[model samples]
Target: MTPAAIIEPPAMMELHRVWKVYSVGPVKVPALSDVSFQVTKGEFVTLHGPSGAGKTTLLRLLYREEIPSEGEIQVLGLDLARARRGEVAALRRSIGVVFQDARLLPGRTVYENVAFVLRVLGTPRREITARVFEALRAVGLSARAQAYPAQLSQGEAQRAALARAIARKPLLLIADEPTGNLDEGMAAEVLDVIRDVWAGGTTVLVATHQKALARTLRRRTLTLQNGRLLKDEG
Candidate 1:
């Protein structure tokens, strides 16, 4: 007789009435206001908007780099606001972020940059080596593992950044303007890598001003204007 299959629970990320504001000498600057959304397991999403539209701010909130001024943000059941410091760190272990600038450590070798997060989390040296190499191979950067960021072209460095993001096998991946600096072909290549990553069951959210790319992907899109959600279409 065939055995019954086990059902894994769904992964859900939620943001509830999130508001982010900054104070500058008695002046309040709003970055995001009353934003609420959710992304389920394996979904690919895009946050689309013009500059200063709070797209980056929204991504940062998900990454827990910035706490919301009001409301709550949760990822995979962990509340960003109430989680302990260690808990937040632990949550981050299963999340990956690719910043707008690639942001690779300029002085480190490509492999080392990719391995840094694991080392910070005290992963074993052997495991770190294995994972880093695997990530590099996954991003098609294995041959340049020893190269420095300075030696890589913009597109190559972006790929390395993506490798670093995926090295930990994060459950959720967030990318901010990942292809902003690339040409049309390179942008397509970057999006292809992102799509492949999403296909592997990692939820992905890419924030970009590039409407053409967003439209091409045809993923659910959320737009922001004046710190408020303007449109959300799935």
Candidate 2:
């Protein structure tokens, strides 16, 4: 899709009465129940709740990593429940996801790790180099491009992961507990990067259990408890 096409979609993500349940020996465990929200382009939304509050499950549904047991989802204008496999893949290309773990490639250099995403999407080599550095610079990792994941500090590794995600210049960036494993100072640093990215016009949805972090963002926040949306405040 062209840049214009990507910009045309007003709602980057939407959920309508979505439910997700897991079956364990005739017992059904509801991970998410009747959750509904919309994240539009250029918005920074936060999803915060304690552990086991189904935060991860909700994000999985949005990214098409898992299917909801009931209800509908629209991501980048594609109906997730009905989208073909190729269509879903295409949708993911426009979305970026970060987890609590940096999840970097142990064998690859930081530069290569960031470039690998573009390579998979068939991005040109020239563009890949430019974008990789640009993303690294954005996350303040350009100087560590030659280092391996194991060689970096926890904060740096996460920043590298962030660089990889944003390198694609995705229309929507989803981070799940991005600062969960960081020290307070590091967490603040990482969040500042995220805020800067949002300032640059990329829509962001962050799922974290840290109430302080959510409050720091000062954006639209959705609270979940026992799989139910408890509050939505700005």
Candidate 3:
């Protein structure tokens, strides 16, 4: 099979009165209540909030990991609530997620880690090699391509995770607490890499609890509190 050479054309996301309620045995807890908003194609946005404020849940909804108990979610022009399994898989292929923990495969080399995505989608070996190196270079991890996850500093690990996400050249990139575990200098480095990705035209949504980070990025910020959108400061 050939590599995935598809270009991204500014992906837009929409949510209309979305609600997510989780039932824990006999008690039902609402994670997100009546949330609605839209992210225009190629726009960089941030979701800022304290823990338990529904930021992660909201993101998971976009990736369709958790379906809404009510309301509607449309991502990349598909209705998530009604999207079939195959559709969801295809959607995810075009979306990249950087979790707080980095989520790198411990045993896999940095290059292989990024290449895994392409290989899974049938990208040819030569294309995978070039794309993997390209992504590593983007995040300043080219020199450590052969390093294992355990050998990396927290910062390097995070950058490697970013490289893995970018290898696919996703249309939409979502990062949660990207710099949460890093120190001042390391956090700045990671943020810079993310900013570069946004500059390259991929729609980006970043979730972080750090107010200072949000202000520093200076992108549009959506504040979430108590499962509600408290503010939309663009």
Which candidate has the highest TM-score of all? Answer: 2
Candidate 2's residue-wise lDDT over 130-175, tens digit each?
9999999999998999999999989999999899999999888999
Instruction: Encode model 1's per-residue lDDT on 1-234: one tens digit a residue.
Output: 878998865656898999999899999999998999878888899999899999998888887888999998888899887899889888888898997689999999999999998898778888999999999888888999999999998888999999999999999999999999998887787888999999998999999888897798898998888789999897
**Residue pairs with backbone overlap in model 2:** none
How well is each residue in 44-135 modelled by candidate 3, as lDDT tens digits?
A: 99999999999999999999988999999999999997889999999998899998888899989988888887899778887988899999
Prediction RMSDs, each to the true structure: 3.7, 4.6, 6.4
RMSD of 3: 6.4
Positional deviation of residue 90's Cα in model 3 after best superposition, in angstroms:
1.2
Lowest summed lDDT across 10 adjacent residues in model 1 is found at: 6-15
lDDT of each: 0.89, 0.92, 0.92
Error of 1 at 77 (Å): 0.2
How does candidate 1 fare on TM-score? Answer: 0.93
Candidate 3 clashing pairs, residues 3+ apart or interchain: none
Which consecutive 10 residues in model 2 have the weakest lDDT in total?
A: 1-10
RMSD of 1: 3.7
